[model samples]
Target chain A: MSGIRLVGVLGGMGPAATVDFYGKLVEETAATCDQGHVPVVIWGDPRVPDRSLSLLGGGEDPTPYLRRGVEALKQAGCEVLAVPCNTAHAFVPRLAEEAGLELVSIIEVTAEALAADGVRAAGVLATSGTLHAGLYANALRRYGVAAIEPDEPGQRRVMAAIGAVKSGGVRPAHRRALEEVARSLADRGAERIVTACTELVLAMDGSHVPVPVLDPARLLARRVAGMALGAALTG
Target chain B: MSGIRLVGVLGGMGPAATVDFYGKLVEETAATCDQGHVPVVIWGDPRVPDRSLSLLGGGEDPTPYLRRGVEALKQAGCEVLAVPCNTAHAFVPRLAEEAGLELVSIIEVTAEALAADGVRAAGVLATSGTLHAGLYANALRRYGVAAIEPDEPGQRRVMAAIGAVKSGGVRPAHRRALEEVARSLADRGAERIVTACTELVLAMDGSHVPVPVLDPARLLARRVAGMALGAALTG
Candidate 1:
């Protein structure tokens, strides 16, 4: 039997984010030819209920649909699973237990990456659900690092940028708004910032941000490549 | 029952191209929200034998692997299917008949799009496998449009560009090579050009091409969106 590991993506929390995650996965792999990369089976069911709304208390439970996506990927013979959405990760432990599959956590990994890079505190840019759940803060705390988020006005801007990206309407204004948020966080003494929202990552270019930015989607892709290919992750 | 058609992607002919196709599918959909877009299930098995090499007569027959990919998508309940790789279409007729799935033809649809846009003749930038099989020539023949190609040296440059893209090494040299080939074809009286190879499309930017360049990947994505939405094709 071939020893290639198959990575399954439980994606489509937002279709564009899922697509971006897949692109990063390809870019991170150390392959010069098609065969050099790991094999992946993607069950991108955009019908999966909204995770952010569910976590924020006004939407249907996404677990059932998330379960179906996991089952589909498992049936397709995936050895390891990865989810690109940070907010959706609130369901990962339960989903992994139920599916009896190994899941790489984006939050845990991103937080560890921060500590590894000697970052003391970083600004968190994500959905209300992720912030409310303290996903990044809780994870970073494990590594003795602190996670900070935008204040009310800045968060409103971040949310607007995320919304614009999700609707496929990322105008120049959206980019400017996200940049302003990053600059505000930097002025407030944030040495680095984490783009925890996939939509925000799509809309915000790292070169334009005032501070160094860590993208969870890119980190997740790196972790996935490491797990699937048993190699060290590289930029 | 909801009338949303699930688009199945018979992909992983090379994983990057498949991801690009999904991104375009999301972009072309008339969705203002996550639920507004069509549902899609992608089975990206990079294990599928090389189609261009196979058609070029020194690679494994890709039919069995193609059948497996189609069957997987069908079992996952994809109502319509799309194959993003142009050379892979050489197997579509037989695969569709065997799987009883309506497979959208990137080649035929592209040829028709050229005619609809009033392109009298277009340069075909593709792999040796596609040129040798006359895939675009045969399809364009039905539309009464002529197909042009690069000379031997220019064809060599085109091949290098495609290889550079597949290896994720899209150097400036590769871009220049492709641009030179496009200009060469235009000088030969080709009114437009088709980036028939997905890798070629990834390497090229339309602004750099002197003549109008049609991207089959984008055209294929539009067709997939139309089929999934039950909408008539629009120019």
Candidate 2:
């Protein structure tokens, strides 16, 4: 089958990223106006511990919240699950196991998208946890997509945007500052960018970069849709 | 009441706008990531007879499509209706009448936003149909906001980009060409701007202009959410 009917989003790593992923799936899908695009079921549980906080021991383990979110989407008739949180991917396997739905891995799809685009050199713009854990770097290297990240200062800009959004201070200016970091990645010859964090898409509010920006959320959505519909999906 | 939620969108017409609205709703709402954003139903029916096509003739009545779209959202459990198309607003009263939910009027909010900003003279960058329809101009004028659109050539550039997106193209150069109109409007002494057409927003892509850009789609979404959730919305 060519068309997958529905995709589920297991979100709330943060509110902003959840929205970014849902929007991208609709934007990228090839669908007629009257014909339905794949219907999406999203679970945006912002109450979950910040994915990083749980990992860092600053908050309670998010496994319970994650399971709840995954179950909510499954109950909504979602055939496949896509987590919009870069940091939460660490917990995805367990969450999927608990929920018993095929959850597409954001990090894995991101790495795959980069390789497909011939991104020999790419940037991983995510949180301190994703970076410190070497999650994307590990996945990308397997696909020959050389991964890059900002310097400490560049990382700060990203962190600032993430902090701003979480604190509800999501001003356009804060987003602009992050775009500057993205510009640097491109300037440094990074072939593609993985918006590894949910908040990072805010930086592109009215912009798209010259090279392909590998949106992990969207890729995961398509894959989830494929799995749910039992549609043939080319890796 | 303070924490009552509202839908927020970053729309740009061209099917993408409606999709963006639905996607953002699912992304940012109080739900699970997999559960999708709140219960948003989108009528991403971009093939509605373009206002330009209709105004210039040889097109079908957008009224039928608009009716169908608004009803679709309502049928899908939308508590509030929002038409992401700027020009199609000419038929909004009809669409609203057909909808099961309250329709958020973008023109009124844009004017209100201008008035609150203390803007008496505001620049406008929209498709030719919207500019010619004078919906924003009339609405703003009531609030004592003198709405000024780009010069004739500027209007042409804006329309070209609108055409591009409606035709399913997302070219950056085409968007830049449209941005020049906003810049020109800013240079012409307009204190604020209304991105009059939903398509005009696709061209904006979060780039900074000299002043505020009143994104009607986002505003409409906010209003829709507010009304849906019974929240008191300001601006």
lDDT string for model 2 (B84-130, tens) is 66776767756666554565778887788778878989888776667
Per-residue accuracy of model 1 over B1-235 as CA lDDT, tens digit each: 1666778887776788888898999999877767667678887877778888899899999899888878877777776888888888888768877777788889988999999988889899998888988999999988988999899899889988887877888899889889989989999988998999877878898797788999899998988887777643231
Query: What are the models' TM-scores?
Result: 0.93, 0.56
Worst 10 residues of 1 chain B by lDDT: B226-235
Interface RMSD of 2: 7.1
> What docking grade applies to model 2?
incorrect
Off by over 4 Å in 1: A187-189, A207-210, A231-235, B231-235
**Tens digits of lDDT, candidate 1, A1-235:** 1556788898887889999999999999888877677688787777777788888899998898888888887777787889988898888768877777889999988988988999888889899889987888899999988888999898888888888877899999989888888888888777788999888888997787778999989999998887888742231
- Runs with alpha carbons beyond 4 Å of true place in candidate 2: A1-12, A19-81, A87-103, A110-165, A168-235, B1-3, B6-12, B15-84, B91-102, B116-124, B128-134, B141-156, B165-193, B202-235
Tens-place lDDT per residue, model 2, A1-235, is 3444446666655656665666666556555432234455455456566677666667677788777667755665556777778888778887787767876788998888777877799977898878876789999999987788999998888888777665546687777776777778888888877788877766555264656676677787666545543453342
What is the TM-score (0 to 1) of candidate 2?
Answer: 0.56
lDDT of each: 0.84, 0.66
